[model samples]
Target: MNIGVIIIIVISLISIAGFSRPELIYKYQFNAWQIKNRKEYIRWISHGFFHADWVHLAINMFVLWSFSKAVIYYFMRSLPGNSSIVFLVFFFSAIVASSTFSYFKEKNNYNYNAIGASGAVSAVVFASILYDPFRIIYLYFIPIPGIVLGIGYLVYSRIMSKRNVDNIGHDAHFWGAVYGFVFPILLNPSLLGHFFNELLAIF
Candidate 1:
């Protein structure tokens, strides 16, 4: 199985197991205060494995699978022999990078908690968008260009993060998407110009 599919399977199994064992869920779930107070730093990476429920897990795994193919293709073309390793780095880094803002923001909030693969999935999706900017994407059953959806996603996440009413981690989505979009370019700077050329080609 490809790394993306492997990840989905691994996460699904772990999440299902965690769901049945509340103690496992509590042990791995992201609690910013726990990291700040007890030095339980593993939560930064571990939280990505557990999720709120099946629907959350399904959505995240589906999105990660959907975009990972393209992102992996681009990585292979861009990074040659080290594609798989580099892609894995990107995926794992995004998980950590996506949570930094929240960790700092809620580090003192004893009640704050988060879970799910949304951040890492967002990273995969936005990274795919960077490679195929003009591809069509459905947003709420409405088709929009990939680049347009990327911008809209970031905007919505930013606005929602400030509102902070929903249980969803808009901050993670925002930061993960940003990390996904940028990490590849940092790995292979040539992609930056390629992205612009692809965008300009659309006009």
Candidate 2:
């Protein structure tokens, strides 16, 4: 089975369990106040495996499934022997990286809580975009170039994060997308040149 599919299955099961047993969410959901006060640091990773509802879970899994194969393909090309392990590391690390800002921002807010795989999903998405900038990304049946969508996503996330008007973790999405685009370059600096070449070719 693909690593992405396995992740979807595991996350879905855990999220479903959390739906029936709300205590699971309380224990595992991202609560920066709890981490600061009670030292429950595991929530950084645990929260990604749980989600608020079926729509959240389904959207995350669908995007992840759509992009994981391409990202892994590029990973295999860039770091041949350890692609799978590297992909897993990339996915999980995004969860932590994505939440770092929120942790600091909400450390004192006792009422704040969050749970979802959006960060990791965004990571996979932007990583795929980095690999193929001109690839067509379908949003609600409308096709948009990956580079265009990536820029729009970043702008939207940044604006939304600053507004702080929604329960959605826009900060996580922004950072996760940034991390995804940079990770492969960090591993193999030459990929940065490839990204530029692919991006400019469409012009």
Candidate 3:
């Protein structure tokens, strides 16, 4: 878990300086170059690893660390020896999905830019809901059912998107949650525990 977090931190630090050291990594930003270039498409994954400030980085990390291990755990227990591959798939897919959504949505807003793993992190959080829908997420001081929290988050992002908020890719957040919602439902197919029993046999 520490290694997972360290990788995210290093990428964020290298990227966070985009505000101050644009000369070095500007081309790597998730903007025109990402939309235009082909070979450097990995920016879709790389961009999700960094954030703009301490608070931004901290929240992203807390969510990633809090939920990702559980995500990996279930996959590993179910499909032993395949944890790494599944994780890679879930991770990279969320990133690319989020990135593609943002690129198409932001083509005209030249000032639009994003710098957080919230989209991918949102995937992890909502994935947890698929596993445990009744679970509680203390999203705020008040306790809210995790599913409600997830839906609330989507609504908030959608509202923010319509308002044309600056500097935030609300579309990515909404779609990432949408991805998280869809991923396990497609994979597991049932709210019952049957998915786990069969999934484990795959190992």
Query: Count of backbone clashes for each model?
Result: 0, 0, 1
lDDT of each: 0.90, 0.92, 0.69
Candidate 3 structure, TM-score to reference: 0.79
RMSD of model 2, in Å? 1.0
lDDT of 2 by residue, 1-203 (tens): 87778888999999999989999999999999999999998998999999898899889999999999888888998864677889999999999999999999999999999999898899999999888988999999999999999999999999999999989999999999999998888988998999899977868
Stretches of model 1 off by over 4 angstroms after superposition: none
Candidate 1 clash pair list? none
Winner of 1 and 3 under TM-score: 1
Error of 1 at 139 (Å): 2.4
Per-residue lDDT over 1-203 for candidate 1, one digit per residue giving the tens place of the 0 to 100 score: 77888888999999999888989889888899999999999999999999888899998998888888788888998865677788888888888999999999999998999998899899998898888888888777899999998998999999999999999999999999999989988878988899999988857
Best by lDDT: 2
Question: What tens-digit string does per-residue lDDT give for candidate 3 at 97-203?
Answer: 77677777665665555666778888888777767665677865688977678778989999997897577778888888888767766665663365355435447
Worst 10 residues of 1 by lDDT: 79-88
Q: For model 2, where is the 10-residue window of minimal lDDT?
A: 77-86
